[model samples]
Target: MPHPASAAPTSRFPAWLLICGSLMAIAPLSIDMYLPSFPTLAGDLGVDIGQVQLTLGAFLVGLALGQAFYGPFSDRFGRKPPLYVGLCLYVLAAMGCALARNVESLMLWRFLQALGGCAGMVMARAVIRDRLEAHESARAFSSLMLVMGVAPILAPIIGGAVLTVSGWRAIFWVLSGAGLLILLLVHLRMEESLDRRHAAPLRLGTVARSYAELLRDREFLGYSLSAGFGSAGMFAYISGSPFVLIELHGIAPSHYGFVFGANALGLITMSQLNARLVRGRSLDQVLGATLLAALAAGMVLAVAALAGMAVLPVLLGGFFVFIGALGCVSPNASALALAHQGHRAGTASALMGTLQFSLGTLGGAAVSVWRDGSALPLGVVMAACGAGAVLMRHYGRSGARARPGAR
Candidate 1:
């Protein structure tokens, strides 16, 4: 089992973990880079809070749709074509976002930009699988998570600083620069990982049938949904947390990045910690523990909010715990879902990416619906997603226990 980022055919641990990790970081970089600028964009563009929120939703829609194209195309062609194409598109899209004069324009460009970004995000996972084994994929995922962790931690801090000097538009410029760096890095370090020796000539009919088979696989569906809904909880928080923290609680807009980054700290720290636990226990065994912990954290937030105990520390600690638990839970769940789908890994990865981002959009929508200028609304959304994931994992594991396993 070779690490996908590893260039050598027989090498399991790629020497360029830093490089592969950075390529994977592009999507998160596109996202967290602008979070600190959300409020500023609303004011500069003369848009309502809801309209500004569409920027986030648009990125997600693009990300969802972008994967459908990149996945099969990558499967048919090779990895680098999509990577190069997507990075170029991301730069163009980021520039468009920088130039947007109105909410509608920003939303459209943001979605279109995600169309490029979704390629980087989805292919990173496929590449890791292309290079590694079940447990090794989890390890590579941890590396990827660590890289993603830096974007959330550093992007907003950079955004906040840039805002003081140049305003929100500067953030897009920075994203464009980041995308350019990724483009160069991929050329220098990444080699093609996919072997199309047995790959079917990728066609519309075959691709449709491939997707159909994936949709009907109960075990794959179970694990994918379990990881996906769990991730939706975090996206709900991402969509609404800034509003709750800055506007409602009176935390300064400049400080929102730190609060957001604090949650990433929780997620990053736990994900790396979970990596250490993988050798001693199976991924499922570890997820059973972590998802329950997240469920408990969400429940506490819900109960505490009901008791009029909705305070800053409670909000911070609860999210820190829930998202941290998700860091451990999600990568493992995704790894498990694709574990046995070795032949159609590209198609399988696409559907999981599709479902994951789809849930993310729906979760963002849920936040908008209950968005009543308070932490309680967001807390309830998180609680429901966390509880839903727990239920899915519970029954999904049992259902598989009684059946023949994946080929």
Candidate 2:
């Protein structure tokens, strides 16, 4: 089917938003939902906590690699076909995770699950680019962030409850059910979003040229890198928080879910506030301001870590602001990056996801390497990511220059 007009039909906007938001939520849901189960999962698999952590890193790697293929494939085919295939793979992988007896098998299945599930994240951004203008897309992304926030807010809580009733393996069973539900929703409600006239070829040379073209756009690179590093900080927190809060700080497992959910709620609240604040303001202005806030929060977090200060309150408050700052940065940076790449929205979005997840994997790994069962690794890594984002936007001269032939 040919793509619809630039904006989807008014009557369909709610459904469109729901579908895109839910799809985008898939990754966070998968990641956060099982987090509360980590201790129990490790015990059941007869592995150390560090080995369990590796599974998360492996999932990030799979997500990073998978987007490279799915983005270009979606551009060649249509959105719905690749989405269907990905969701099917997700269901199978999730079920495999539920059945796995060892950490090795569990890690492999989780990686495969990410490979299947990340199609939603890549395509959700591409769909936003395909359907909206730059500023409008930023606003839409904020709304999608609000919707996506529900998953993280509820996921750990739900995972905890399920673990209480059953076991860690049941978490994967629940995720498989989620995949099935999403597949049915796509089949019933989602129309093809890719326009036939803009279809990219499937050849390797064409794919290389497309990414090469995007790389040459300094404006795109600045925004993409800033967003990528900001995401790295968030992933660092994701990788380290369970150990820091529960294992080291002595927070109970059930309460850990609430603490995690509270941070997610803060992020959701900030995204909505950002959507309103950016109205009539330039997205660049919003992005610059938020990066500064993130940088300052990072500094405070680092000091608290290094000085051996009030650990829990410092982490909670610092991250409340730090992650909230991301609420502003991510959508605006994404909008700015893809503003000039309408014809290759999928490729551009794919590259953006690749950068974010690849950097995120590294940040998470760094935390593991420096793990001392304290909040120091989490604080230091997150601080570095925030500082890195600020530097990229400042020295990178965001939006000051563009590629010669850029849109």
Candidate 3:
């Protein structure tokens, strides 16, 4: 079938992109916004920084698992219902997080909060797929990165301010309020984009088979893995940056947001550049170039750390390049992955998200486990994951050529 018309007019920033972007922003806001509070959380909960990092891991785990459920549910029930359910759960769970009095309870609440927040992540992509062709989807996803990028740039800064004035717990209260606002916007402005004719069944065996089929598709695996590992590098940074910057480097907790936001600004800039580049170039071309850039940056970062040259300037430079490259990498990879999977967009999106966050969880966990009061662990993880992304893309292309009939 011919691809549906573009989701919204391309001439100007549309309302639909805004809404979808906000939905996608949920994860970033939830993850980045509270990062400045790691030290405070550790002190308040009577735990060390590593334990506080575990809470982040818990959230990533929830995000990964929750997407699996929401993907199928959105596919079967139409997008809006699962979003309603998820957002409500997110609101409640945010409150739970705010009220948690111990590290264990905070971890559990963070997990639940992620479970609720991830609906927006999966469904936003599916909704975009529901309305646009692959190339248009590429541009749209880039636009989304532009929209969603604001959250990370602002979240940490806002979070730090809240932490200073109201305390660490108040950060979650802010999150709770953000969740409510998004929920209201969804109810008032968003429309269900899933066409019933394309809806999949909610059967157990069918879902398993669908996911298995996705796993076996080499092209899908390539795009998914490349995006997953590239993104995993970012998660590694997020997991380790608090301790590395504040404790080891002697940066103030409040100033950490500026550093984080600077990298995020790089991300936003590169994503928009990708958007313009794709208008003339193939998605694969842009993806290939960015993946190489990421690998190079990752290596530079790893080398700097190993050489004991991981000063603030060196670390920020490496991170900006690596993370900025992801601006081009993720949107292109995602558009390519979902290019041929429109019939089951929700399922495809879910599987892609699962891979991304599952690797992300591992990245975060690896940092926490390797916490040695040095930046070496974070650097190594970023470099390794970036290499993984490049290899996956290369093999994915080779496999696609070898099995011309795979899709």
Candidate 4:
């Protein structure tokens, strides 16, 4: 195992950390970059806006399912092998997306793209767990949020520029190139982090039983659900924002990237702050506080929408607050969820990703199905997710307190 001191808070940020963050960034890059082109994509494909949104949902589904397999594969073989396979597949699928002719084909390619890209997400978490304890892992995750946050801030701007210059097809070409570049980086720089002696078997029944046991773990469930619902709220924003800003509020597609970047900036700032906050307080304490703040933001958003006050400033403010809270919530919740699962870190990480993306898929689908040319549905769904996260956190704390020798 690598020295734990290498991940120490005072140590300089490392190259391997950057590689892990880049790996985990595939999702945000794939999701956010195409957002600015939604209207154009709909027009070019000769489909309605909703059909274009289906591609996003399909990608989320792929992320949810793909992580499950990647986790075990990483554990059974080694981290680098699954990453090599996944990135290769990602490059090919991205090329497929670039060449897609219709909405149906686009959705199919996006799903395949996600299947290939999510290996990074699963393995990055497992790798971090393999190298650090709970507290250090939280700090590392916060650092990762800093890195991943840049994707949302830049992807749309890059996408909008590509859309303006070449066309929507060019966006997928950019993604393909990115996947290829990352694949090369992984091959050259990423050392295998999994200790071979501790590798879990890739047996079907064993994997199922492992996942079932994790589900039965109250602390794990709490952190997972809290993180999942918090993420679901963000996915709700991602699904709803393009229409709410560009179509309803008359923000030009070309200029939409700036508005999206502002929200992402907020998220990034809060995540960095969370890194400091955890130094003074426990992860649970910080997570609980942030979850409450998220709940408040969501309720405010819902109230504003219901009051027919879905103006630009109101919506943006609500989204900034709600999404920003996730920066703190995610790192803390993820660290807590996998804190005790070092023996099966890959499986734990995969299950957590699966739940998070599954909830996110539902959140995106809800926004699509409940699209009434208004922001009410988005507000309600986000608010509901926020409430659920808070409740789950409370339940988890209660359960922890009830146990005789709980962590």
C-alpha lDDT score of every prediction, in listed order: 0.80, 0.86, 0.91, 0.91
Instruction: Between candidates 1 and 2, name the one with more favorable lDDT.
Output: 2
| lDDT value, candidate 2, whole model | 0.86
Q: Candidate 4 on 339-374: residue-level lDDT in tens?
A: 888888899999999999999999999998898889
Per-residue lDDT tens digits for candidate 3, residues 28-57, read: 999999999999899998998899999999
- Evaluation by lDDT, superior candidate among 1 and 4: 4
Q: Return whichever of 1 and 4 wins on TM-score.
A: 4
- TM-scores of all models? 0.94, 0.96, 0.97, 0.97
Error (Å) of candidate 2 at residue 306 is 0.8
Instruction: Point out where model 4 deviates above 4 Å.
Output: 1-10, 402-404
- In Å, residue 41's CA in model 4 sits off its true spot by 0.7
How many clashes would you count in candidate 3? 0
- lDDT comparing candidate 3 with the true structure: 0.91
Compose the digit string of candidate 1's lDDT tens values, residues 106-214: 9988997898877887777777777767787787787668877898888778888898899988889888888888889888887777776745568899999988888
